[model samples]
Target: MELHEYVRLDGVGLAELIRTRQVTPPEVESVAREALKIADERLNGLTRPSFPNALDAAGDGPFAGVPFLLKDVPIAAGVPFTLGSRAIPDIAAAHDTELMTRFRRAGLVALGITTMCELGLSFATESARYGPTRNPYDPARGVGGSSGGAAALVAAGAVPLAHANDGAGSIRVPASCCGLVGLKPGRGRIPCGPDTGEAAFGLLYEFAVTRSVRDAAHLLDAVHGPAAGDKYLVAPPLRPYAEELDAPHPRLRIALTTDAWSGVPVDPEVAAATARTGRLLERLGHTVEVATPALDWEDVLAGIRGEVVAGVAPLLSAPRQPPPEALEAVSRAAMSEVRAFTALDLLRTFDAHNRVSRAVGTFFADYDLLVTPTLGQLPAPHGTLDYDNPRYSVDSWLRRLFAYGPFTAVFNISGQPAVSLPLGRSASGLPIGVQVVAGSGREDQLIRIAAALEPDFATAADRQGTLDQ
Candidate 1:
């Protein structure tokens, strides 16, 4: 296959071709390398390319010939783990994390590491460690982070799928910013590691961002499970995720909300996109009603901040010193601000989590899904959220981050499943993702609704263009 043709195929299609011996693994790797050459010159998405691994893994499972990329934060055996900061240099992983082991077992060839924010504390993908990752539709704009780099590569056709994890909106925000599909599985859907335990407040979930819904589905099937010693596990799906794509869901009652939880004005383009998506869902035979669930924005934000601070405090208190340039201003500021929270304050935050989780759970009991814009606006300019600006207070910086992604954090807090679908585009031609969220362990419903409504908003043709030029 030619590089252009390879770039056009989704992960599932590429895997099938490889399985049938229609496309040799070496041929796929060659095209992937060529695609990366184009992507590096344009998207600034990769921190380091793993061309040698791609060559070695070719002809290796169902996806033996398929090339893949990992987010910079995860420790993939033998791949450079930068964590999107100069603080951590190019240290190769000595052994694969459980997630990477699954990727290798599934026959995915590691082609490179994608960029992200330092410590994943930011909403935009501009790292002092590796400059900025540009959106393919418009190079001047930001690709959402800390999975920003992975999303850019997939959206730009550099790769059909790439590893991405959502702590706050890392995966979905980028999927929204670039035109792609990002699914944040319910808690414990994909194992993190035996040493790490669960993520902050059990809010962070690991999954991939892909160009097609089925690709996301298939990848989940390949990687979903609890590594022994995990804190908890999400309930297994009724059927395999890939098989669920073809099964029709009952007509769902979806609640749509355009009011930004922060009470800030969403960009008109974003509002329009949400409205358009609501219409699409209606056309697909689902009933759509505009409703705002009772949610305390301040309490939710405070709980998220508290969890993040408390979770990272131990790492921050360690005796080892960070290189001056390794830590960015935002992360440093975050570390400083979090120190003020007393043990009582952390308890209060946990109290807030239980309260919010129960409240959101009650709302989902009445509605099948809640649909909203993944972000309040179209992709912002690169570096707008960069940590170089010292004038911004920690509170002010966090406010800005929430404004970029208000809808996603709620699911994280509630430990529910959510997905961002590339169902619309901004007036300026950038991709606009519609977030579909379901109750905890109800990812099946979210996937069904997304697959049902995907065809109405945009077609595959909308994704093709001069991503590199």
Candidate 2:
């Protein structure tokens, strides 16, 4: 098959092609690697030393021979795990985590890694250690963080889908920027691990950014169940996630809001795109209403700050540690701020989380979904969230980061399922994503709605070839 032909197929589509012997795994791998090479040359969206023998390394299962990439976090083992940091360079992971084992069981070919922000500390993927992951839409703009490279590589048509995890909107931000389907499954919806469970205070989710909702749902079916003794696990869905996409949900009651949670006015363009989507939802027979439930934005931001800083502290201070300057300036400053935190501080953060979660739960009782801009604005310029810029102190940088992605952290805080759909674009043609959030553990609702709504605005992968120019 031609490169464009292979690249356009979603993960499930490719697997079907391979299963029927219409195309071999080796043939698919060749086309994908060439696409990744082009993405690297044009978008700077992937890491170097690509793993050429990934198809051979991958285990067999339902989606066997499908190519995928792991973000440069501690998601899997036995590969070069950088954690996107300068402090821990060139260290191979020792063991496969539950997510990794699940990936193998589900038949995903792990074809190397992608770039991300150091320690996933910022929304932008401009890592001081590895450089910026540029948006495929326009190389001058950022793809948005920790998951930036995954979003960019997929958007550039390198892969139909790639692994992505969200903490404070990491998946959705980049998905919005790159015009992909980015879903942050509710806390406990996917496995966290044997070494540790309920990571990032139960606010993080492991999933993927994909070119189509069906791809996202199919991968969810393959990897969404719990592992034995997992500290956190939700009940398995009654049916497969891909099946949920076809299940009817035309009567969803969606609440729309331009509120960014942080109360900063959303950019007019982003707000407008969200409104357009609201109208689309209403036209589809779902009732859409403009509303914002009463909640403390202060508590939300505090929940984000406390979890991330505490999580980042140990990773930097571990195993003899690196010199302070070896770390990014903002990371250093964040460490300083968190050093004063007491055990009570951690408890209080969780308490606030519980309170806010219940508050959102009550609101959801009246609505099936909450609609908002996945981001408060369109994609940022290259280095906009770069932590090394001497101009931004830790405080200023935090302010700017939330301003860019105020909509996503609230769902993370509430432990609710959310997906960002590439359903709108700015007048200048950059993609914008609209967020659809459901109450905790309600990914079924998210999948059903996303599959129903994505057809109108989701870009076809074949058009992504233009990104190379």
Candidate 3:
């Protein structure tokens, strides 16, 4: 098959072709290199290419011949790690992260590192250090970060799937902006070990942003489990996540909310898209009710942001801190904010964490899932949310960041499994995803609902163009 044709297949499709000897992994890697050469000129999605090892591993499991990209923020063995900031210049990992080892075991070949915001401190993808990763649907707009580059490459058909991690809205925000399936598994669903026990209030989770729900499922299947000693473990699925895709989700009571949790005005286009998603789900034999859960949205956000600052504080205090010039203004400011917190303040934040977790847990007891727009608005122009702005106060900067993406962080705080499905689009043509969130340890329900909704929702072709183009 032609390189462009080969690049168009989903990860699973490519894996089957390779297993059947219809396509070689080296060929896929070669095609991916060419696609990146063409796509990166406009998208600026890749930070570094990993062609050598990817080619070496071709013809190796189910995904032996399939090519993949890892977001620059996470450590993938031998791949350059530059959290999209000059402060942290490119440094290749000496060994694979636990997640990387799982990917290798599953036959995935890592081909490159995708871009992210500086230290992943913001939701927009314009890295002062690495330029911006533009949405493939419109070169002028943003591809939400810190997983922006991964989302961009997948959306542009540079690759079928790419690694993405979420602390706030990193994975789902970009998936919403770029038109893909992004699942942020519940805490402990996919272990981030050998380096750290957990991330920021345990709000960070690792997963991928992909072109199909099944690809996301397959990825979770391979990576889900405790690694030796973990801080905690999410309840295991009764069966493999891949199997859940075909199971019928019982008729669910889904609570639909268009209210921006941050009190920011949600763009009318986004509101319409959320409404349309609710209507579509209703048609698919599910009940969707528009109601606000009884919870203090502001407090929930404040708790998550506080934990983020405190959780990442230790990294900024490294003995060999990056030169001031190398760091983004927002990152520096956030570090400064972290320094202001007293030990007692962090303890108080933990108290807030327990409160928020319980609130979300109780809300889910009555409703199987909660549906909301993945983002508050459509994709914005590059550089509109300034990560490097010295003039902006930390509160002001965070307000703007939360305005762009308010729905995703809540699940992260509650440690519940949530996914963004590319179910709708803005009038200007950017993708708008609807978030499906389930209670703690119930990824199966989220996967089942996502699978049922996938066929009913619009495809990437409907909003963008043919992947095979």
User: Which candidate has the highest lDDT of all?
Assistant: 2
- Assess each prediction's global lDDT (C-alpha) against the native: 0.80, 0.81, 0.80
Summing lDDT over every window of 10 consecutive residues in candidate 3, give the lowest-scoring window.
49-58
Regions of model 2 farther than 4 Å from truth: 55-60, 390-395, 461-469
Which residue pairs does candidate 1 place in steric collision?
Answer: 87-326
In angstroms, the error of model 2 at 375 is 0.6
lDDT of 3 by residue, 1-469 (tens): 6765865678999898878878766677777778877778778888754455452342455567677888886466556687787887667777777887888778887777888888887888888878988888888899998899999988888888988999888899999998899999988888887787876758788889999888988878887998988998766788998999898767888899988766888888888888888887799788989865566776675776685585557667766777777677877777777778787877776777777788888888889888898998888898789788898656777777887887888777778888998888776777888888888888888888888888866664564633455
Lowest-lDDT window of 10 residues in candidate 2? 460-469
Backbone clashes in candidate 1 total 1
Model 3: number of backbone collisions: 2
* Model 3 TM-score (2 dp): 0.95
> Any residue pairs clashing in model 2, and if so which?
none
